[model samples]
Target: MNAFGMNAFGMTALPTRRQLLSFAAAALAAGVLPRRAGARPLDDVVAAGRLMVAVYRDNPPFSHRKGGALVGVDVDLARAIAGRLGVGVEFMELTAGEAVSDDLRNAVWRGPVVGGGVADVMMHVPYQKEFGLRNPEAVLFGPYQREGFALARNPMRMTQPMLASLPDEPVGVEIDSIPDFYLLGAFGGRLRERLVHYMTIPEAVEALVKGDVAAVVATQSQVEAALGDRAAGFPITPVTFPGMMASSWDIGMAVKENSRDLAYAVGDAVTALLEDGTLPEIFRKHGVTHNAIPVE
Candidate 1:
């Protein structure tokens, strides 16, 4: 029998060691195996019996801590992928770096000088061709969700649909977020005086729900999660500005460029999760609607 203890269809299986040795000899003779020694990230993960995943901390509905445990859509997804790989998972919560490139460098390939080191995979990476070109060391793939900004406003405060109505009252947004920057300069800087910045989108949305701000601009998922049942009273609408080139973009996972095998494996897992509707289910469990990206 073969090493797996299975015989071929209608034939006896070859002996284990002998057949393996013969195949190795043939492979060596044919130069099928490279002479250079290198360690694959996948191999390391399998050998260590654990997969390390990098996820952003304080981002709700994606990755965040809840009830004294790290829990979110991305957290569940990472655990699912690790289960598929038959390995344990270690989630490394990290604050987002200044830019995606810095995150890729610090989390995917080269770990920070002080931290525990790079993770095997990082979720919520922007799946843009231009971004991929800029960061060659990281391979961004498996576009799972398409995310975009939306404006959620308290109906009791402002009933106007136009963006010009916000000057009388302040509008809230996450500090340094795309919506914050967009509103800061929108309408020839007219809204600048009425812009209020919060540390996170949830905080901005909270202010809107409490009637502290007339409106809040943030991602659709973030707005929905923050508003919860109060969302029924508020209106969440897609937002478009003069300088906004794209309202939506796809988010994916990233791995070191050298870890193509792991990337492909993770991609397959993501595809399977999407096909079976597990990914969307995870998002729904977090009280957020999942906007899936069309697979190309």
Candidate 2:
């Protein structure tokens, strides 16, 4: 992914409103094809015979590149959903934006001017009420998996699995992530000075494995994937702090607010996948444990 969070697709320079209007005028004069009037996102996708899915790039065990091919649980899930929809799948790799709302705008509803516009659907959206309320332009549904923060500690440096032990030694976390904020204010801010921020969770885990930090805090699946073979040595355990809203949260998919049909179809596909144990099977292929989110 690039600095702007664009993946291999490369970010296109966004054109100004005047430039867009001029271009549209030129295209119209040239008799360029326009979208069918009043077509919904799902209708456009189905008519084009392709389902474009936005997923985070460089996020392992969920969505990432391997052997020059995109492979991860989210990748598989997207493909499965596309298959269920009887359309070809296109995975748009993206780096996470400042917030899920930004991601929804850039990837789900309003496409980045650079990436040929927004995708039909985006995966790994937080299935929370407050977020949905805040982002009325997007629809969040189809909770597929439950994820929680976890600590992976180097046993030689940290004897206990608790978050309180991190003050004496540095702890690693992805910069600007939930764990980063949590640790910064944890224990009355005692661990603030000792918090080591990295660009990503895998980087933090690597620092922990190298003994540069006493522990690393990230998602459970991320810790597991980063530990890999060394998982036997570094113990991963769920961590909690006072005033935490919830230990775990459900991850789902998001579509444009107008694409309720698309959301429903994707939700049905997810249900079928879960019922046949395909989602868990995808997690197993990535060597991470899956915690199924009960359908509500």
Candidate 3:
């Protein structure tokens, strides 16, 4: 969701606040951690009375802090899963790594060098075949939400709400995001000078509100949250960049590879939450639409 994690939408993401973690090599080394190491089994987790959930810091509508309290979709999902397991929830807020692979190593299987030990389970991980295969040390599963991109435009500025018009109109995008790359590279770089960069999608959407840009391209949830009551003035629709990598994906959780039992238990809990409509409620509470459940 960049609503879920930074760099979740792109294969080659731009450098973020958490640059390529300097400890990646050591954390990802084959023998750095004993198999299963600190990852608690399902039984142990219940015994300890809490599930350590790792979520991205400052990821609004997903896991951001509000008035010094953590409240968002992913936070609520973690609490729901822990509630189902009869345990309390403990959060391990994460800074976005250069890529999701690095996040898996530092938060799911191996602890980062700076030393907040690995969490028992991490939320908002990309659930994809190639990505899962590449990070075999972590078992990625239980995709609860489907994420996609959208365009939020000021109707007063752009009479035409089509992707084709972006080349000629000013558009706002989060710096180093899928939207930024696509807008910069698409149409033979014609949109490069027309692009305005923001540190976050909400900022870009805000710029759209202020008429600083004709349109803002970002994850649907981010645009929705930013637009709030103002959404009526703007058209928000599912959008795609023709040749951009991963314009949409399913977001799930990750655990140590040795913790398959934990994965199964969490999966069952997630399925129950989705079936009973609790997940969608969480999204609605955050003012973000639950687009659709991830395809199995």
Candidate 4:
């Protein structure tokens, strides 16, 4: 995992999650379709009467399966955007690839080798200038949320939000995550033995509840969603690591470069949703805190 990047896409495992942050150069798969011919324009999408939206499969609080139905913030947002556009919504669930660039190629600008065509828009893309510059084939826009790390601690065990308390109190983190690495090396490695690793943030939060760890460090949304009603006692607050590379980042949507019109239309729709309070409500419904993107 690149220390400079957070696992914004919410892949279940560390290896795949790490790959999403690299944003490195990548080649499209052999079966990927040509960009200009593959990406549908706004008029073409309207003519089809439905907007195809791509979301990462099994990404909770964002996109995931619940009661055998696909749902989450991204899913609801996609439906709302399509509704605003006067079209039906169709979802194309995506599996995380080796890098975010690969995902954009598969989800926004090109079709996967197995022949599923790209979606008109892909949700939960990292809205970073460097990333956008590296992948000119896709346009990144509509930053809906600012994602960052937070400490969710058991009040009885950890009275303070500061990392200073972690030396004696165990801290849980997703194995190989930025938080995990941060806890391992931060404070001159004094807290190494106190670090507990889990496969996911939910698991780490579970440990916090069970008294297995005094606190769990992870993305704010994951911490909030995992705690749910139990969040009443546990406090969620930000803590800075002395040498942390990226403590937070904005997340948005991506469209094919040729689909700038679609991007603009979707961005406008999101702004309307935010202004009308629908966007924050969507996040609340999923048990996640809605951290709005700062106005640029």
Q: Name the weakest run of 10 consecutive residues (lDDT summed) in model 2.
A: 3-12
**Residues 65-134, candidate 4, lDDT per residue (tens digit)?**
9899999999999999999899999999998765676788788886675566789999999888877886
* Candidate 1 ranges with C-alpha deviation above 4 Å: 1-40, 160-167
lDDT of 1 by residue, 8-51 (tens): 00111234576557535544543443333222477777888888
Clashes of each: 0, 3, 0, 0
Q: lDDT of each model, Cα atoms only?
A: 0.75, 0.76, 0.81, 0.82
**Model 3 alpha-carbon miss at residue 18, Å:** 15
TM-score of each: 0.82, 0.80, 0.89, 0.89
Q: In model 3, what are the clashing residue pairs, if there are any?
A: none
Q: What is the lDDT for 5 in model 4?
A: 25
RMSD for each model, in Å, please? 15.4, 7.2, 3.7, 4.0
Comparing candidate 2 with candidate 3, which one achieves the higher TM-score?
A: 3
Clashing pairs in 2: 12-114, 111-117, 111-118
Which ten residues in a row are the worst by lDDT in model 4? 3-12
TM-score, cand. 2 vs. native? 0.80
lDDT of 3 by residue, 189-217 (tens): 88899999999888888888888889999
Off by over 4 Å in 4: 1-37
Q: Rank all candidate structures by their lDDT, best first, as comma-separated numbers.
A: 4, 3, 2, 1
